[model samples]
Target: MSLEPKKSILNLEAYKPNFGASNLKKIIRLSANENALGYSPRIDKELKIGGFNRYPPQHSEELIKTISKIKNLDQNKIILGNGSDDLITVIAQTFLKPGDEAIYTEYGFLQFPQSITVAGGIKKIAKDINFHASVDNILKLITDKTRLIFLANANNPTGTFISKSEVYRLINNIPENVLLVYDAAYAEYIRNDKYTDGSELVEKYNNVIMLRTFSKLHGLAGLRLGWGYGNSKLINYLMAVRGPFSVNSMAIEAGIIAMKDIDFQNHCFDFNLKSMKHMEIELEQLDIKFINSSTNFILINLLDKDKFSAKNAVLFFKNNGVLVREMNVYNLPSHIRVSLGTEEENKYFLKLLKKFIRKNDS
Candidate 1:
């Protein structure tokens, strides 16, 4: 017999990131929800790496300690991964058995399905209300087989979020056997008073794991550092499944400095808020419909799909040396997700977008 991969792995769709005009001399990339202001300058000055010859700490102890101090969490209850994506996959592997079901909203992060399917779990989708993760709908999808629920607060692509009350409602309703994988990659960007990042729930509930990443606010995407906080028992299970030395020394060193760089983090947050607001106003003035964002990115909704579909808009932007996320992967064929960029980058993107609109009109 010919060698073949598992059927579940065969059925999985690869995650595609927006790689805009890499060959271009200068391309404004606002596709991936990356930190526009870039990473902390303190990382450059303060980060030290001495042991290149040996394997890094298996548990990323120092990094975890730093995160624990900053977030006031139990270090024993925290687990580090190569990135949040790695943690997600480990969660699926540790929890899901063959034919088990995991629920996520319609527009949830694509990694949820990928991880679940890879772990031989059935993927269940709850319909979102107006691109928002609806608590009631997610609860309705529960069954004897459901083992995990993946929810991204200040969700990517749509950039919409549910409040703390709604999150609690979901938590209170879901069977304790079912683990809620709360992905809070964008938590650093949220200024809303209602958002919780779901860390507190992890403390109270044994079945909940709150996932976080330094990729976004800390501008450590390239380094691929992320972490999860949950009950000690749950964290222990994840740590058992997590690869030894998954987190490298450079990432650990950088993460420690990045976590402590409060000034740099605030700067990124402030800049994102201001730039996003400016872009929102500009989109309104141009009569372009877009979602009100709670995170660093805005979702530009091209309502009249026949005239200005996301596919066409993405092509236009790419041609004009501007890269933005086309949302067809999330089944949002008429929308594009634009990450907040530097002032000049934002202006250039708007200008090109305006020009694209004019061209479409003409």
Candidate 2:
């Protein structure tokens, strides 16, 4: 007889990540939303010093201290993860039980639902308005069985986020029994005055967990390093379930250096602001509709969905040696998502975008 897994496990589809081919140097990759500027140069010094033979520090203490200092969070309440996805899994496993429900927005990160299902919890999706997470809609979906709520601030694919007031409303209304998972992977890229990663909320409420990653602005994606801040009790439970040394020494070292490299961080922040504004102007000139993004990526819609669809745009870009994310997986068939690359890369992508539009003019 065949070995059988749980029904939920059997029903789950494998996650298809956008890891570019080995010939990545020849391709302009805007599919994964990774930082194009790369990690802080200070990491090279640490890598040369060497510490590969020994096991990583227990709970990554030094790394935690560095993160705590930067975030102004308590060291005891912080936990490092292999990546933000790792912490998401930890949250799901620690808080959810069989037959419990977890809520996420319709266009939120795909990991939220996958993590919930792996923990044998029901996935409940709340509708979004204009590709933005609707606070009212999410609240309406909540029930006594709802064990967790995953909200991706400056959410992926759509690159749209709710205001601080909206986030406050959601938190104030949510029951104390339901844990809030605020995924802030792209938080560093946002410069909006009205935005918060919900870190302050984590300090105020035992039910909140704020997740951040070194993968985006820090450009340490290859290291797969991330950290979460929450109440001491919640963090202790998450750490209990996490494997000792899930975070490697190299990642920890890289994260520490990256966190301290304020100059590089500021450079990337400035570049993104300038490049995004330039792209926005170009898009407006070409009559291409796109989200007013606060994150490092933009979601562009092709109004002629029937003829010049998102799939066609993806193919056209690929043929031109540029790669953009096709949004069909996110149920955005009319839209394509592209990450802001360096200035030259942005110009090249914009040039090809114009060429594609001209070709499709009918």
Candidate 3:
């Protein structure tokens, strides 16, 4: 036998991360949609004072309890991961096999297709109507070989959300033999009453599994703590495949404390609420098209300037010490994604953007 990795591994393009700690101080970094408030102070205390020598729980026992209380689901249904990305991979590992198929919206998170490939499976791209993923379109993509349907709420790059009624209809029509994975990593950012994080459906449908993370609202992105909740039957299967101690010891200690820090979570939520409103007001005056978002980030469709796409504008921002996400890889070269930031950072970015747009006209 040849000394080589799996053929699938050779074909896969690894997920690219944009910012690192060193690059952080050099630019504004609105690319990742990371919480601008930074880590919870409690996370800081836990890191310096929390013990790192011990082996953390392989599955989240207590952390799931809080999530159970928050989501109103039984604790037995949850499985933990290093991050929601890991949870996504775990789903592929458990459910998808060689020659099986996974379906996702055309503009879903980049990791969805990558995860399916990592499991030696093929990915089928379904269409999205405008910014929202069309559930009906996804239904049409299902075949006898399709084992999974991966969905991103308030979808990546576009930052658009599917309505709750549409979600309910999709799950009802979906075949019981197929698994549906709800990747709601940005679920915490939504304030709408109509929004259902798929918790109710997960209760009603054994085929559905939902994933969440401590990265966004809790400001624990660096810690990499994330989890999935579904029926105990599904959770057990994931646990069997997931590596032991995949979630770090320090992250568990930090997570327990961070979950209890409700005050900090609310503060971050309110901050995003204010920043999103203000940024929308500023963008409106420019008369540029944008997607309506109910998440922490927004899709900005910039006015074309001298044959320049939004991808070019992103590099311009980077050159000027600001950073934002370019969506060319997501098949969205005409747009960019920006996370809500601090009052000062938002003002600085707006000033720079206005100057760039103005110069193009002059």
Candidate 4:
């Protein structure tokens, strides 16, 4: 007989990425909430010189030091990874044991369940209130077997977020042994006043960790760079389990340049601010139902489930050479997520969307 894989591995479905057309040059990409302004010019300047022979620095020292300054956290609290997903895997390996449970909200990141399953842990889904993570619902599902919780601050698919006060309440109530993984992948794009990204809680409590990524605002998705901030003990444990030299030397150099390029950072921030407001105003004028997003995207609710479903909207945008995310996989059949692009791209998306609405809806 052939060798059989573990049952946990067998049961897992391969992650389906966006439509293949997403990669084509013809389409205007608004599906992946990427930085529309693109990467900093400084990255190119740094990468022209070579460092291909040696392995990356063991701990990503210089990059972490820069992040420490911006975050006002100790370097000991930081753990760098190939990407935030790598850290998620490390947490699963470090904390989740066979038959133990991990909690995620109903519409949490797809990666959470995959990470849990790969680690041989039982996954529990806590129902959300409307589209936002309901802390109360999450708390109710916490049995003694629960070892971890993953909350997406400035959540994806649905661009809603909970306030810092609410996050504090959740932390105060969670059992001390259970760890909270705050997936703040979109934290940099948030312009709200009340959001925390869970850093304050991570500082005060040993059980909370804040995970951030360079993929979004820093325009370093190609580099696959991300980092986490938590108690020194927890950070040390993750570092112990993580692979050596996961963050390559090239990525390390690019990350340092991107972090220090304050001009580019400000440019991205200003563009997003202008575009998000524009999206809200235009969507309302067209009578489109959309979540007021705190991040770089908006979730348009196509209330006419049968006539103008999310699938239909996807096809419509795809036909027009614009790429937006379909939400059926997220159990949101009537909603589509659109990332804020540059001014011209945003206007084109609005134009095509308005035309689609008039053609189908009217």
Candidate 5:
């Protein structure tokens, strides 16, 4: 018998991530936007001390309580994921079905629509600006068929962000029926008092579901723990759809530790904050155009249009052991994204970048 595949799986393209053996360089890894120092002391201790016994708490009830305490949220309103990526998939599965449509910005996180497609929904792409999600364009594109709208804050590969006022306006304009997914994976990096992470906003705006991750700031990328704060009714539905043990023991242990070790997390966040400022100053001095990042990554476009494509610059950086991502797939073939590293690593990266810029100048 022939094993015939479904048309959707046959046609669907897998989301291509930037990390792999090819990006394993000796100098510094500035591509993935992961913390350089790795997980904190408490996380390390607890993972080892707690032991990955039978499994993580079947429902992540304690984890939800911990997050609620940290964010001052209602435990009932939160749902945990293996990683925030899993949360995205579960949301897609819960809300989307065949013939439904999910919308996202053209150059936002490349993976946002992959979940939608995996859920058997047609993904609609809206226009963008500076690679950030454009709410107006998204509003224009929404229809009765639209089931979900994913808005990635401080979007990947571009690192540009939308202001609070803008996001609020967009939230207000969205119709009550369509689910609005505010992906705030990098929201922990925000230093501005005016900015809202959407966790708190979701309580007020029942249509919104907001994601938060321990991967970026808490140095727990390896642990792969995250949660979504959403309306209680929606969260209850997700609880039914998600895997009972999607979060492993080690990850929950790590998340528990990471949240408690606030001082260490703040140190990492502050370091990235300062590093981002200095980097912007250096890029400006070098006369290179770049986007202002709201997170621990910098997106720069090499202006030597005649000589270097983003891929070529990526090649140049790769040979020099500085791993960065080329934004060709994002429809911006001329830009590259570099992540924040420790002070020493940033110095090394800057040296390599200077060499590349000068060589390309000729």
Candidate 6:
């Protein structure tokens, strides 16, 4: 007889990165929302790479200290992980039990449902309002069995975010028993004065945990480093469940340098703002509709779906050596999310987009 896994594992459709366009050459990869300007130059010059023979630091104290210092977060309330995904899983395992329900918005991070399911928990999806997370919709899903709420401020794929006031409304009303998992992986990219990463809520509420990553703006996706901040009691619980030495030595060293490099961060932030503005202008000129983005990527809506569907657009971009993310997984078949690339890459993307429209219009 064949061995069987849990029923919840069977229900999961495995999460795949590089969803499509795998065979394409990909001259300009705007699929993943990575730092277009790349990591800080200081990482190359200042990073001290060593300690291969020994185990990494048990707690990654140095890296945490750097993060705490820069982010103005408490040191005791912080915990590091392989990536934000790892931290999410740790949170799920720490709090969720079998049959407990975890809430996430319609367009929230794909990893939220996966982590909750893997921990033998039920997944409840709150409907989004015009591609934006609805605070009321999320609150309505909560029940006695609800143990967690996974919310991504400046959510991925759609690139839409609710304001700080809405976030406060959600947090203030939710039962204290339900832990709020605030995923802020794209927080660095947002410049809107109305936005808050929900980090402040961690200080005021024992039930709130805020997650950050070195992957996006830090250009350390390959290194896979992320951290979480919460009340000390909650963080202690996560640390207890997390694997020992989950964070590698190189990731710790690099993350510390990345955190300290404010000049590089500023450069990236400015470039992203400029590129995003340029893309928005080009999209408007071409009469293409897109969600006004507060993150590094924009969700291009194929308004005339019958004439130029997202599926056809993806193929066209792939054929032209540009790879963009398809939104089918997020149940957004008519939309494609394009990450902001270098100046030349963005130009190429806009040019091809214009060409595609003309060809289709003809």
Instruction: Assess every candidate by TM-score.
Output: 0.97, 0.96, 0.95, 0.96, 0.94, 0.97
Worst 10-residue lDDT window, candidate 4: 16-25
Q: Which segments of candidate 4 are over 4 A away from where they belong?
A: 22-25, 304-306
Question: In terms of lDDT, which candidate is strongest?
Answer: 6
Better of 3 and 5 by lDDT: 3
**Worst 10-residue stretch by lDDT in candidate 6?**
18-27
Supply every candidate's count of residue pairs whose N, Cα or C atoms clash at under 3 angstroms. 0, 0, 0, 0, 0, 0
Lowest-sum lDDT 10-residue window in model 2: 16-25
| Model 6 Cα lDDT, one tens digit per residue, 145-245 | 99999999889877888899999999999999999999999899887789988778988999999999999999999999999999998988888999998
Q: For candidate 4, write residues 12-92 as lDDT tens digits.
A: 888775644544568888988888889999888766457689777889789899999877878889999999989999999
Q: Give the C-alpha lDDT of model 5.
A: 0.83
Which tens-of-lDDT digit does each residue in 76-100 have in candidate 3? 8888899999989989989999999
Q: How would you encode candidate 2's per-residue C-alpha lDDT over 1-362 as one tens digit per residue?
A: 89989877997898876544544358888888888998788788655557689998968777788888987889988989999999999899998899999999998998998999999999999999988999999999999999999999989878888998999999999999999899989999887788998888887888889999999999988888989989888888998998888898888888888998989899999988998999999999988889898888999999643468988888888877788887787777889889999888999999999888889885
Q: Write the per-residue lDDT of candidate 1 for residues 1-362, one digit (tens) a residue.
A: 98889888875678888875466788888898888788999888887868799999998778889999998988999999999999999999999999999999898888988999999999999999988999999998999999999999978777899999999999999888999999999999886788899989987888889999999989999999999999998888898999988998999999999999999999988888889889989998988888898888888888653488888888888888888998877777889989888999899998988888888888
Q: Which scores greater on lDDT, model 1 or model 5?
A: 1
**Deviation in angstroms for 16 in model 1?**
1.3
Of 2 and 3, the candidate ranking higher by TM-score: 2
lDDT of 4: 0.88
After superposing candidate 5 on the true structure, give the runs of residues whose Cα lies further than 4 Å from its correct spot: 22-27, 48-53
TM-score of 5: 0.94
User: After aligning candidate 2 to the native by TM-score, how far in Å is the CA of 21 from where it should be?
Assistant: 4.5
Q: For candidate 1, give the lDDT.
A: 0.89
